[model samples]
Target: MTNTMWMRGVEWLAASAADPRACKWEWDHGEGIALLEAGRFWDVLSVPERLGLLTLDLLWRPALPVPGPTLVDLAAGRVGFFLPPDPDGGWVGAGLRYATRGSWVAVPPPYRPARSLEWLVPPDGTGTLHSPGTLEDALRQANGTLAVLAAPPRGPRES
Candidate 1:
């Protein structure tokens, strides 16, 4: 998907997390999947907004055979997770042998706007699924130096 489209999707996900009626169920990438439904993986969208957010993204690891949307919490400098699973099988991400069922992991930024998934550090594929409280803590500990990176770059000042 295009960058603008992706950003809009993420924004929608974040905004509609609370009201199920707003987040309608639909197929993603032609796969029969619900976009965001309570008790489903997409529930992460409901993550409280108090956590300074950078952007949310959908990770499509071809090796795994399904696509998963990830919430990129830049203020916390980590990729938050609460997904269910891929339709074909487990979820695939950077680094690691197999896929993870569901859990939160640190996605270190490269001190700039993320151009691709390469910018993120893959989850270890094992750990306790992060709670909203845990995510809040993680963001609390993240360095602020890169927080600026999350913002769109400013153009040259007018003369």
Candidate 2:
């Protein structure tokens, strides 16, 4: 629907895919989805070091730190990890949104020193489905795993 971050993200993704060293994943941006044909994006989901990065600070931490390629959350309003769909079958940030700070804009990230999803959630129905841990702890763990992303490939760029 909205080109917003989705379009800009494609620019960064295009570069990362070409880099060969960058990890990539397939994302469904409503219109369609694409993959970077690079490394393993699932690396972020499986790694242990990534556990440390729960907040945006941790998300932006140097796991596979590619300052030039640019990284976008693609979920503009998403504060941390996954949250269940709202009653309307919609999510707070279910579309092509992204982190404003990282290598893009100047606005402060939504993540706190240690974020607290407990605080972020409204006291309404089905909020429990999205239960998460302490903000700081989650971000830390997530970032720990994300560190792998910061690394460049051992070999040179592929053709």
The candidate maximizing TM-score is: 1
TM-score of predicted structure 2: 0.21
Candidate 2 — which residues are off by over 4 angstroms?
Answer: 1-6, 16-31, 39-159
Range of the 10 consecutive residues with the lowest summed lDDT in candidate 2: 40-49
- Model 1 ranges with Cα > 4 A deviation: 1-34, 39-42, 45-80, 83-128, 143-159
Question: How much lDDT does candidate 2 score?
Answer: 0.28
Q: Candidate 1 residues 22-108, lDDT tens each?
A: 332222222222233323332332232333232221122243322233445445444444444334433232321222334223222
TM-score of each: 0.25, 0.21
Residue 122 of model 2, lDDT score: 17
Best by lDDT: 1
Instruction: Quote the positional error of residue 127 for candidate 2 in Å.
Output: 36
